[model samples]
Target: MIISAPSASEVRMSVNKSLSSRIAFIVSLLIVSVAWSGAWAAGWSPAAPMLGPRSLHSATRLANGNVLVAGGFYITTVWNFPTAAEQYNPSTNTWTSAGTLLRGRRAHTATLLQDGRVLVTGGESTTSTLAQAELYNPATNSWTEVAPMISPRAFHTAVRLQNGKVLVAGGAPVNSATNAAELYDPATNTWTAVPSMSSARKQHSAALLGDGRVLVAGGYSATTPFWSSAEVYNPATNSWSSVGSMSTARVLFPLVVLPSGKVLAVGGNSGAGLPPSVDAFDPATNTWAPVAPMGIGRYVHTATVLANGQVLAAGAYGRDSAELYAPATNTWTSAGVMSSTRGEHTATLLANGKVLVTGGSGGSGHLATADLYSPDVGSDLGSALGSGLVQADTCAATNDSTPACSAGSTAPDRSFTWTAPSSGTFTVSTTGSSFDTVLSLFDANTGAALGCNDDVSASTFQSSVAVTLTAGRQLRIVVDGYRTRCGTLTLNIQ
Candidate 1:
């Protein structure tokens, strides 16, 4: 048997770009297999994978509502780091190249800045523990190295401040815990030293409080056991002060700020073994209280607060089980299990209220599999869409030819609400549709006709129409066949 992996550069390129977007699409999607119909998919079924298999990477959601996954190593016989990066679109359920990083890194921090760019900080590459820093501009889709940090550090935590700066602190794994802390200002593109923590913390957790303070808590020091000590950083004063201590010392746990503003630190290695116990810190009271324990001990897991205000704890070292924490009861219940065991992976919340879980070390090693967890999906396709897939069989048959299609166009149609991200002139097409098609645009709320077309650029039947859109414009897109026939069709806009 023959085997080969796409190089890092092969997979990272911009998608939906102007001028030959198809070429960019082909080049960028050499590894990822993004398709059109994941809405029909069920629980934990595979969505598209990334450009390649990776672990210990970071996933940050961009302002455009796309996910930026950057820099993780391949587990092909040896741990190999890659500088490549990719973006995932929840709307299309596709993966495309965001762009490569300036430095190859793993175990790093990627934080989204206020200016719609991303700040990537220190982590290990093939060469060494890196102090290198870079910024990712989504508008231009490129990376530029910024000023390196004052110290070479990895395994640190970075939280975007309320003041539009980023606070980076702690180090671990490859390096000993350091109380060193610094701030990165996007305005000046520089890093400045800040008051360090009272004690060293590595692989710790950080959360922004409602009052604009940042709470840093629990992680291994450079030596000995992990610490239960916690502290808060006040941006106004540019200082750190010791706060209430946790009941247990842990490493690699999740610190999630609930809707009520209390921070919940859950499930981690408590010096000896993984513990399911959780701790809650109330900034209002300045105290730490013990909460309920999980069904199983888990470390290196991911926790995300859902729209419904429930916290989902997923994937631990060698475990596929998941649990949900309820704030009202302060308890954990079995949520379910993933299709496979995953640790060191990422889970992102999409606008549609579904959770997207991506690459990590799974039971088979570095995972290329990704899946969606949505409360809406069911086993049957018709029941899933609530509209029987809403596809037209023929282009000219769905409507009476109103200067668009021929007189016979009628039957088989689909209605969709498209939310515009930006104000622009967009060309919507059913170019490669399976049959002759007619397209129409309508106001989603009023059902008033906005635009209609039967053919594009003197083509036979495929439809294309240009529409001017404003940000947050809600549009209703309808497509139908031109004759007494029905078939599948793919839609695109650029």
Candidate 2:
């Protein structure tokens, strides 16, 4: 639910249903082109390169639409992992040094906490396996060390729970796989041990299911069969149970929940080599079934769900080719190719319908290059609305909120700057979403915060705010999530 607002009454908005309907009509036209032409229009384009070559780095999209790239091995004379971090600004198409972590780390997981801070968990350094953990504040562009994990672990998986707690499970503790798990409470800045996995696993995959349970699948285990087994963790019970095993045992695969509530286990490795064999698990049935194979086999690859409901499988140990999986037909199709072959890399889906792929080892070597894959090249708001009175009815943006707004928020904010078209009152709402959202209107040019609405009368999980606009006035709208809620935002604006 949205945090309570301080205002006694809603602003002077008359609830212009007609205006909102017109905006929806405008958005429908914008997406009609997408339906006709298909989303994957443009291929790969090079973005500003990172300051240093990196591989196995963690890239987390901040609440304010910026990406944080941190902790990866770079090649100079030899491979070296640096604690330094960098921020990527999509608006400016440039990279700037964000800050530095307390210690050099690689293979760590950086999760955006419910309160907008980044919790960086265990990763290894040149000398030791790391039990150390840290927090990154985007506003301060600095890192703060937090309570360490129970043990040194790398190649582990961490997912934010529905209740704002973090669940970290399955990774090598010192040298081999461990089933040990722990919970990190952001409010307490503390960690407590939880039930371990049914099996000790490393290099596995985990995803939050629709029911709030986490499904972890196929990874290397201590015993030997390279772990084809799967398990599900129930937060309510604080335990894990064996689920249906994948048809083929594999490690280093990606487990992702689809829009249909089905979980996909994509390309990965068994004992021998990377296999293109793909599988999907139906939560409703508690069973696993093989699906269409990827065009090519890839281990250490990445799968990202597109706005169009297709999944893009990109990069592998030696392959640079990418492919897309369409659930409608249960088929795989070739996507664009990246500039460099990538393995142990990261692919993050940006709010603008593009995938941002960052540093990894490839055919050339470890890379610092970044690539933006636009499935819908014409999806940019500016392209459709162009210098207009109103933009699209619905749009997606990462909140990437500043430190100032994070005080009561677990989600980041997305800011929109526009010149007012007419002098009148306007109503902005997040009525369509299923999660709590915060809406604020602003004087964009002066950087002044205007009215803020944490919740609307219609729903606690949604927000609506009204503010008057003057012709030619510089306006900005910031949509922030109330807590740990950052995903595609179907924002409604007038």
Report, for all candidates in order, the number of backbone clashes.
23, 15
- In terms of lDDT, which candidate is strongest? 2
Q: How high is the lDDT of residue 354 in model 2?
A: 75
TM-score versus the correct structure, for each prediction: 0.71, 0.70
TM-score of 2: 0.70
Error of 1 at 415 (Å): 19
> Candidate 1: where are CA atoms >4 Å away?
1-35, 38-43, 172-175, 376-494
lDDT per residue for candidate 1 within 1-494, as digits (tens), equals 11123234323422211234333433433332333543322235556788798788898989988889999777777778988899998767689988889778988999999999999998889878888899999999999999998888887899999999999998844757789999999899888999999988888889999999999999887575688989999999999988979989988898999999999998888988887889999999888999998889888889988766888899987988788888988778777778789998888876555678888888899886776665422211111111112233333234433324444555476555666667887776666455546788876778778888865643234677788878777777777755443456556555
Ten residues in a row with the worst lDDT in model 1?
379-388
Residue runs of model 2 more than 4 Å from their true location after superposition: 1-41, 377-494
All-Cα superposition RMSD per candidate: 11.0, 15.7
